[model samples]
Target: MKPLERLGEAKTPDGTVLQLYRHDGAYLIRADGVELMSTRRHLSEDKLAEVACAPLVTKPKARVLIGGLGLGFTLREALRHLGPDAEVVVAELVAEVIQWNANPEYALSAEAMADPRVRIVHEDVSKVLRNNVGGFHAIMLDTDNGPEGMIMKENSRLYATRGIAATMAALKPEGTIAYWSVGDDPGFVRALENAGLEVKAMKVRAHATSGPFHTLYIAS
Candidate 1:
């Protein structure tokens, strides 16, 4: 069957969505109710989750920061791994995205907004990190497309030397920072080292499929 198409969406006290669209069998997230993500790839949710928390050996009793909620995949993974003492702070710049998760009428985020462990802040994550009062045990940024970014151009700052320094300061000693990338970025690895964090950079497929690859940075 063809999926749902051109349904209208919007931002209330929640987050943003002009609309959504159905292409083939997949519904996409659209600015004017158009589609930007898909259900066909929902199979990858568990994979993204695995990568989000792969750095932790035992369950972590600490704090976590998840940059963006792209389809809520990584957040789901992070919550699954953290121990009961853990808390997740999500700083999403697009207020609409936060609203998207709460719009029960359309079900944009599929209940991610309701997770007890998650605290959604409708502000820019960079500012939150720089001004943050406390530190985290694991900081995972599924934000940006790696060195490349998907949303705002200003996001490039998050991968810079100064940005890495801010991130490092937000972490506890031996804390882990995990970043998801659309591709590999040697420059980011260098920046992480400059920040004085031991780093691991590796490539992993988006899902079990060998095709459609992506990269990850695990630093501490």
Candidate 2:
């Protein structure tokens, strides 16, 4: 096997180390020694957009907000599922990640980024949710590992009761929010319910019908 080569690096707003690596034709983004995302395994990430935007297919002028742009799988799938009138807003905390996508060396989501329906925002997603009231038909969050995990400590608020309320307020009537987690989070489920969302939890494989399973929470 070939060794992983470090291609670039950046620092999160909170000073966390974000490194980009390439191995065997695949790209990886890691933070503090933990893999944040990999080009080789993103089935669940694509599923996040598929399940969330499934209902929006018929909804005209559908607008969606994607909290994280890891590898752009979610955004790419979202574009595939929605119509020409639809719009996708991707909020990414790290600017370097966006740059990585645009860099031909990585060849990750550059075309997706150029799609007319897509908009890029280099800011925290929570702020976007708080500021845009009833603006989105669907919201997909794959920012960190899960509700309890933290790539950035501030992201925790997005899963808390208050944050969930903000997210709910940001959605249009019957609009859905999907959260991608490494595993099930019962407490987070309860929090979503307490915030008055109708919730459904699904167990999805890391790859299509194989690999470890991850959890995707869909709430309306």
Candidate 3:
């Protein structure tokens, strides 16, 4: 068996360690010691984009905002679903993760990041949502273990009441927002409803054939 090799490491604002590793051709990103994302299972990430962007497939020049660049699968999948004229703005707080994905030697998301439709913003996703009022046709959140902050303590603000309001305000009248989670959270669903959104929660597999179930929350 090939050994797991640590490729890169960085420190979060709270000083927790973020590390990237490769084993048997698969890449994984972990916060502290918890796995955040992995190239081995990304079906749920793909579904997050598919479900969020489906309504905008035929809408010309649609704009989408994605929180977190994790492995770039969500961005790549969003690009695949949307038309050429559409735009995708990715807000990634960790600059090192962007560098890792853009590193061709890592064979992660370099190609996806280069897609003409993608605009990378090296900033907090909350700030991006706050600044872009009524800007995006779709917003996808696959950040920090979903609705809770596993990597950064500040990330929980994205799912807070004020954050949900800001997120809803940043969307067009009919725009949709999708969230990816490791498990179901009824409280999060209620928060979306309190923000006046109709929420739909779907259980998705981590991989196409078989893997642990994950949750995809779609709100509009």
lDDT of each: 0.66, 0.90, 0.91
- By summed lDDT, the worst window of 10 consecutive residues in model 1 runs over 11-20
TM-score of structure candidate 2: 0.97
Question: In candidate 1, what are the lDDT values of residues 61-154, reduced to their tens digit?
Answer: 6677888765676777777776666688888766555665667765455576677777888776788788873577777776645566444455
Clashing pairs in 3: none
Name the top lDDT candidate.
Answer: 3
Candidate 3: list runs displaced more than 4 Å: none
lDDT (tens digit, per residue) of candidate 3 on 19-116:
99999999999898898889999999999999998878899999999999989999999998999999999999888999999999987989988889
- Overall local distance difference test of candidate 3: 0.91
The 10 consecutive residues of candidate 3 with the worst lDDT sum are 145-154
Residue 36 of model 2 has an lDDT of: 84
The alpha-carbon deviation from the true structure for residue 53 of candidate 3, after best TM-score superposition, in angstroms, is: 1.2
- Tens digit per residue, CA lDDT, model 2, 76-172: 9999999999999999988998999877666799899989999999999999998999999999999889897788776788888888998899999
Taking all chains together, each candidate's TM-score versus the true structure is 0.79, 0.97, 0.97
